[model samples]
Target: MKTNRGGGDEALKFSSFFFMPERPRDYLVLFIRFSVIACLVVSVSLVLRATFLSSSPRDYSTTYGLRFTTVPQKSIALSPTGSIGPLNVSHILFCIAGAAETWIDRSQYTSLWWRNSTTRGFVWLDKPVNLPQNHSDVRFSIPIRVSDPGWTRFKFSSSRAAVRIARIIWDSYRLNLPDVRWFVMGDDDTVFFTENLVKVLSKYDHEQMWYIGGNSESVEQDVMHAYDMAFGGGGFAISHPLAARLANAMDGCLQRYFYFYGSDQRIAACVSEIGVPFTEERGFHQLDIKGDPYVYLSAHPLTPLVSLHHLVYLDPMFPNKNPIESLQNLMKPYSLDQNRILQQINCHEGKRQWSISISWGYSIQIYSYFLTAKELTTPLQTFKTWRSSSDGPFVFNTRSLPPDPCQRPVTYFMDGAEDVRFYGTKTRYSVADKNFGLCENNTEHSELTKVKRILVTSMKMDPEYWNKAPRRQCCEVMEGGRGKRKENEMLIRIRKCKSSERI
Candidate 1:
């Protein structure tokens, strides 16, 4: 009985050690499942937290507003008769008041508003506290100095003018202003289209963009070429950091260039010297208020945005109806190609020459020529031929022989204008500054010979339809002339040449 009991006990021990009823296994599986579920819950919580943080707006806010000022240099008579006194002061006051009213009215509906306008009492004047002097944060004040009757005569030299403007802007900064992002300085003559401007500013990354303006000058080029950096004083913005830099640089700049002439130029020079990154937006202009279809602004188109300048020409009733409007209206119903041609040609009554000058990239020269109107019209055919021809050394003839490739057709209203001098030359031939004797030649003659060949080839073609013929005729004539014609005949043939060849 004792042996049997002992064996039973051993058997019981072995069963307990090797195969307990799967309860432990169940417990172990449960633990693993619970652990996995806990991990998933934690992971989900973390993901939610991260997403919330990533999507939340920053704690600070950006303040934006328009700042306007005016500088009148001289007075001029408004009417043809000199009986009336100079209207300069009245004109400036009118502009200042208009700008003020417009901004005040617009601000009621928009978040951005002007601090001071003629309609609204000057509230910016109340603030006189100083703030940090750091590069990213600055503060100063501007005293209203235009209280005199002839304030129009108060010409603050460019340097003083810059300082005065800078002081006012610096002083206007709200003390410890949180996240003050940008300050836009504009002339009193400017009218801000806040909605459009805000929409544009929202699209750009403010951190990367600095010194935003209607125009900008390349620092290197402006300094090297002594060209003005395009700071359209009419409308410009500076980021907080740039403003700090400007404040610091102002004194040194004034000392260096004591007699600066152009306000925009001086600002650009200072910014360039300080190595600030600058950007320009298109819709800004300095001189004209006419809105161009292809441009955002009339005179200086910034990047892709459009802004107008010289608000004096802006019609209150028809804001966009100046020259640009007229052109746009005339071409509005036309096809794209027709519109393009019109734009290229300035098809308006007083703007024919305007069109050709822009197309030829000779605006100044064309303007000068246009002033000589009768002489200009006399060369209409010559200009037309020049416009039509692709290659040069244009030729003309007084007495016609074979049709001249260089000969341009002329239309004259005046009678007895036979033997119109059509100018043509082989474009390849460089005009030698040295006087050409009857048979002068030099060691560099080979270059001239090559050019002459190219010119001859360009102008070779049948005379009957010189302007309408294929370009290959020119090549044929140059390569396969029948024989040497008389000098006079060659000259006459050149004179009768027309411009029909395709490029």
Candidate 2:
């Protein structure tokens, strides 16, 4: 019993020491240590969350819906040590020309628009002259010489200014500039989105002799140049190999076409002899308007802007009053949305009643002015463009005709038992000829609202339905068929009920 009691005492002594209360200083130290460890753990967790999980910068494309992109544009996979971004454009030599008086304005434009460029700018003057401060280096005086053909016909003459200019400029930089890949030509007043231009050139192999340019603006100009000439003021690019060939032949070739009028035509004629064709690109603006016209640049032209010509006379191209600021504004929305920018819509349920505007990838938004879908009795201007100072180049013009879908350029129509059919085309508006003026014609609603314009025949109706019921064939109508033309075609049309007869 005494030995058992001794063991119990030893146990009690061990328990008493283990359960003793800590002092205030010791307890405070323990709490501080716990708080420090907790703070460290939380700080580390927050740092890890921020580093591993965060949204990236906004994509430059003005996409309004699901941006289904395959990979980053202008991005190249690089080795661990290399950097990647927009392509470098050192291989291109920019050769620009202008008359003596406009050098100052052109130089200012060149500095801003083609800033930080790997370019050699040349301004060809009409006579020997002293240039402004920074302009002396790139400017060259007239009587610009090239190898003469040594004959009167082929020789550069006073009357044929274009021939002389082309021979001198095109030949001057041949083989001498060995390292360059392309020679891009433009007037000093021409403004270029240099980055987009670089990207456009990168797509093609510079080794292949390439001649790329844009077409003339109007039908009259087309008739004059016969659409063969590249509008020179708009700017054009020549690959190294072609430039070499042109340098060799242009002097002799210019002697042949004494009748040619402008520099562009003469250059076009020379190239025609050389057999390198003009690859047309859309971004080049060749003409100046009578007044300030912002629609050409701002209204979503299908191509990326390469250059704009004749900016001096026209109204400013951008929101700002300054021309340099206007030039920079050309890069907005990086790329044009080609697919379904304007959908070919039939006058079905939603389309006819309200206005449906489908902008690029963004979903369709329907705007309805009336409470109920009814015929617009009053003559409402279907399209009108308001030129408010605030609204820049983008006015929703339901008034502008769907600029495409030109059928056979003729006018003829035939009527079937149930519907009227237009064989080819006449005036833009689709209408059944009545004793008086014409009203909304078929499903096409041709000139009605510029929104969704399509002919009745294009609605994917069954061929048999047209043939057997009130029916006849179309494309074949003009060709030949057993069914004679429907003389009474305009008489019968099964149209929807009109709202009111009082008007």
Candidate 3:
């Protein structure tokens, strides 16, 4: 089922502000985390955006020369009642790729949103599926075909992509009909944010000859042969004109590069030869970045976050993908605000001052702050009362009163007064310096208590409100209880509390 791992052309050479390793697969995790901060041959000023807000139509026309007659917008909002807002999401046609074995894992998460007809769908498989009599809708299924009977047979490695993937390009292109303006293609495990996908596509004209794709292996994949071949796994869009042209030219192109092994790179070759360049959108992630994508997807930057690739190896998208409880009940009212999430969104390292990364998975670290975090271990019998100190009794509560586990912000309670100053260009940025999230004292409640509460936010609670949140209270336990603390790894083992009341 994991066959057709794609490949890229004569590796796109570069001499700019960015550097991608020749063997990216080996170091994808390190590359994704550090690349954003370290490898910038020419770091283009990142256009910081707030979540849920739409940006003005971006003009990629001059660079890629891919614009056409008209470009619509993709920012739609849901009204107060949770119904459809101004934007109609059905404009997208989702083309999902997977073998018979992986189809369930890939399509089930997205199935939550696929019932809507305006947003049509198709599952591209190696062979036709036999649907149950009770489930007789053929609208979401497409069996790929190749004149060569053996074209679809390939291993789950990148070496065979060039030859096997031509069938996908053609099969996907065949679905580029007039009814839908955009055609999006992705592997089985890809999740499409219909709302964001629409928002992104609306920026470009559907009639134009455009290949709305993402990075192959570097920043600004727009360089020469790199021309932004859609990373097929993260999901890519094709305007009708561009898709039609690709489908029309696919046969001859396939014959020309018959021995090529990477499907995506080969497609890029065809598109490059035909003159439709790929325009990258940051939101479409194409790699198995950090293991837990909860934070990445939950509070992504202001850009319309579109897709997350390689979910087969991580925890469920949400432990409770669909929580029975309402989000309003579990989350703060402000969780609905799009601007705050985008505005406070940041990533940094605590090299100089000390920073703490709230992590859920190998790479899915959430909040990165200048504050240093220390584990405060105390014996239940030996400890008497809680008092404020440079040290903290921050409680990691898998029990009561905490929002979502992912929502927990790494915090440090200073002795007398802690003034936060965000500097150091690479690892930190202050609120005054154009960034999202608030790094200030917790004054919302009666903070003048036994212990003071300072809130460090990543704007993650809102999305997790509806699902199961980690009720584990650490900082909140100390702040909510009595506290004493210190810095960095002290590594003193304290026995786990057998009962809540050991005082």
Query: What is the C-alpha lDDT profile of model 1 across 210-261, one tens digit per residue?
Result: 6666542222323432433454434666555555556555546645654665
Tell how far residue 214 is off in model 3, in angstroms: 2.1
Model 2 misses residue 411 by how many Å? 36
Worst 10 residues of 2 by lDDT: 408-417
Best by lDDT: 2
Best by TM-score: 2
Clash count in backbone of candidate 1: 31
| Off by more than 4 A, model 2 | 1-87, 132-161, 168-172, 319-322, 328-503
Kindly list the per-residue Cα lDDT of model 3 for residues 92-181, writing each as its tens digit. Answer: 566666665555444554554455545565666655555546445432333333223446444333354445445565555443332455
Taken over the whole model, the C-alpha lDDT of each candidate is 0.32, 0.45, 0.42
In order of lDDT, best first, we have 2, 3, 1
What's the lDDT of the predicted structure labeled candidate 2?
Answer: 0.45
Cα-lDDT of candidate 3: 0.42
Give a tens-digit lDDT track for model 2, residues 82-200.
11233346566677665556665566666555544355545555544555455344322212222233322454434544654565445445325434667788777777666557756
